[model samples]
Target: MHNACLFLGAGCNAIHRMSTLARPACLGLLACLLAAPGCYKVPVTGRAAVNMVSDEAVIKVSQEAFADFKKRYPVTRNRAYDQRVQRIGERLAKVAFWDVPAAEWEFVVLEAPDQINAFAMAGGKVGVFTGLFKIVHNDDQLASVLAHEIAHVAAKHVNERLSQAMAIQGGGLIVSGVMSTTGAGALTSNAVLEAYGLSTGIGATGFDRKKEKEADHIGLIYMARAGYNPEEAPKVIENLEQANAGRAMPPALLSTHPSYPERILQMIDLMPKALEIYRQSSQKQAPQLVK
Candidate 1:
């Protein structure tokens, strides 16, 4: 006599009435069904993932959100910041297109000197805050930031996230609900924006730990391939730590990204391979000042 749930056939009473032992079995069945047809490999790292969301749908939402962001934030007036971001972003884009073939790459610097953040959306829209320049001293360091954001897009982590949300929330219909709205609902417009690593409507949530680490790995390789010194990759993390030394926040376990120390160690472990790519790259260029 229980009514069906929002999307699934079985209703609230039925779900609520299920025996504790039965709930696990039901969830397991749902997981199997979601996984059966959505298996795919992450770009660059080749890690397996189950993503049921479509690229077209995710990109559609992303483009709309990016347009909205432009309207809300004033673009930077600093010619130097704009030029440096564009220069390095374009260079990274050239090397990144193999993974994100549909990218309509656009790099922007938004005038937010108090916010040290940068993000890349699914459709290749990227924005960096002016405060980031405080941490990024050189073009190579900036590339580490840009490349990491780009890696998030090229790896389709947004789609992967939406897919995970849909799977956990019961059905694919959740995506429609999330994408159909224009305002501040947890799963509405904020879903895509949050997935892209922006701390919008909601407080301060970024990508999950795994996705953040993967972006770091992929970004290190990307910057090195694009002829930026990968050694500077870890320096960016160091700068961030020093900058935030007095700020109060959650512990590493509760944070979206790995601890800065862990990130530096990982980059060090990844350095030899990244260095090899850098040594062989024909596109090597001298580091340019960002400030």
Candidate 2:
């Protein structure tokens, strides 16, 4: 079954299981309902998806969770890191703006040199851990990281994910109600944060492989369009692989993402197109060394 089908398995399967003779009728009814709304094409890859949740709901939860994170963690004081993140983030945000017009973009560098991860919540709440600097060596490489996070927002992966959970658990109203409040409550906050690739007390909870790869595809184009070197995207994966060489488990960035080799090959396959975009970009900027 297609991924979207899996999310609707409960309803669709019931129609399939009720009776063989009723299959066609049930399927027709279900299809009509599903196709009526919540259907969309992903921006870069153009994959068809179903996102049943409202953007306002997702963004509300995102802002609340981001606020919670801010309360729990200290923002970095590194002026250099701050300036670099702000610069690269702004460029990527401009290129990604149309995809997420409702976004209220904010880039934050948190003081966590031990956590090598970053995430972008829907509505443009982004956070980068200080530890990610250990692997990212240049402005372009940093762009690769930031662009990937932004791609998540541009693609509406979080909204789709929330919709999936609501469908599976049959809690659309419950979840929406929680999201319609000031704090978003713990349940809604945790779900939204996890979908955005973080867990409240547990650190990073990565998205599925397909979403991560989609982010890579979209991010590559975004960085290229922003005049950042697209080649550094593959290099970013290589660096992460190298950094994980002796680790017991994958880092947060690679935890549920496509394998490094797989991601590198996919990025290489997409490189020619990305290069063309970079060549045509108008906002060329010199690569600044991160160290």
Candidate 3:
């Protein structure tokens, strides 16, 4: 009886010690399931995507960030530029919203003449910098950019990216918590996080070629559906080649986006299909220059 009492006491003592490590590990495991349940298939490509974050949640996050952005970065006062974006956005929205509707859509041209970039977010938030006009030889190219950005949103890339981030963070927190109790384990956990650079905040998006190529394929369809020549898609990459030159490079393995040459070649392969769509669309118009 005395030996059994001693064994029970030892078991209780071990449980007390393990309780501290077990809770965070369990929470981290729970976090994995949080976003994993929210899977949705993409529209055009029929690709399956897991977006642990709900559309409402993603839209809320996007609007909050966009609001913060507008406050810090003044929007352009160029009426012509603004009108151009709105016109294109309206046309694209009519089609894209059918793919993935948002509660509202707003297109803003920010006053960054030297900043040649653009992005589209959930809830139909889009920004095109004036600097991008330098690369805009014609409306087709602009359509390519807009369609590509729209493709990203329609594919729910932001939500997928965020959910991926949450899963990683939860995993890290759980690992860190479990390992935190021991000197060697803590060192190992910190090393793992540092190696991958998974800090508490969102990290570099690490845009992969698969996503970029998928966007290219869908964007070609979108521009064609919007009455733009899908052939102009490659021309956009030629422009990107010019714009991205003299830009910084990460190690070849870690580049967030596909190399410009690679994207151009892939677009070439997709042109035939996009052209068919363009030829069939009733709204086809002569390519218009945005200058």
Candidate 4:
């Protein structure tokens, strides 16, 4: 009887000690699992994605981020380049052909001569840097890059990525609760969370590579439908490959994207379908190109 009392008392004492973080941790875990990300199908590819963020919230966040970016780097006012990009972008925008209702898509030309990158924001904001003209060659290649950037959003990669991060964080909290119950010290428990966090960060690259391949597959179709040759995609890849060749490279898995050859092969494999879309678009092309 005395031993049972002693054990019960000790158990109660341990629970009291853990109450600070452990109780809240348990509640946090319950809330996380109950409020798990909802799955939605992306526009063209139909890949089911788990994302907790609402469309309204996503757009709001994107708008804020975009505004900050523009403040840091103003849009170019060069009339000729702006008109040319707007022309091609408008055409490409018209033939985007995604199931998702397009956001009021906006295009901007950024006059950063040293910046060779282009990006698509989640809410359909796209920026193409002036330096890209050095290798883009013409409208078709530019279309290829734009299509690829928009495909990233069409595929819901950003939302899915956010979901992954939330899951990792939730998992860490759950584990912390378990550790607290096991009488782990704060330092030891924090160390475990840190280790798991490092692992989570590294694992994120895997999905990025998958999203890249998915974007490449859809981008080709988008550009083809916009009346550009699907073959132009491979040319862009070749340019990227040549540019990256001299630079030191990371291994395939650790890299955020596939190697140029891997990406080129993926585009090549999709060429037949993309080519058919191109032919159909060409048949329906304006009798005279848009002025």
**C-alpha RMSD in Å of predicted model 3 compared with the true structure:** 10.9
Residue pairs in collision within model 3 = 35-52
| TM-scores of the candidates in the order shown | 0.83, 0.83, 0.75, 0.71
Instruction: Indicate the TM-score of model 3.
Output: 0.75
What is the alpha-carbon lDDT of model 3 when measured against the actual structure? 0.66
Instruction: Tell me the tens digit of each residue's lDDT in model 1 across 1-291.
Output: 121145456443564678743543343344335345555577789976655566666777788888888887899999999999999999899999888889999998998989888999988999899999999999999999999999999887877666555544554422333322323233455677776666456733667877899999999999998999999999999999999989996898879889999899999999999999999999998898754
Assess candidate 4 and give its TM-score to the true structure: 0.71
Candidate 4 wrong stretches, greater than 4 Å: 1-37, 171-207, 282-291
Worst lDDT run of 10 residues, candidate 4, spans 189-198
| Reference-based lDDT, residue 172, model 1 | 41
Q: What is the lDDT of residue 227 in candidate 2?
A: 99
Encode model 3's per-residue lDDT on 230-281: one tens digit a residue. Answer: 8888887788777878987676446657777778888888888888888988
Q: lDDT of all predictions, in order shown?
A: 0.78, 0.78, 0.66, 0.62
lDDT tens digits, residues 173-232, model 4?
Answer: 222222222221222222222222212333323336767888888888888888888788
Q: What is the lDDT of candidate 4?
A: 0.62
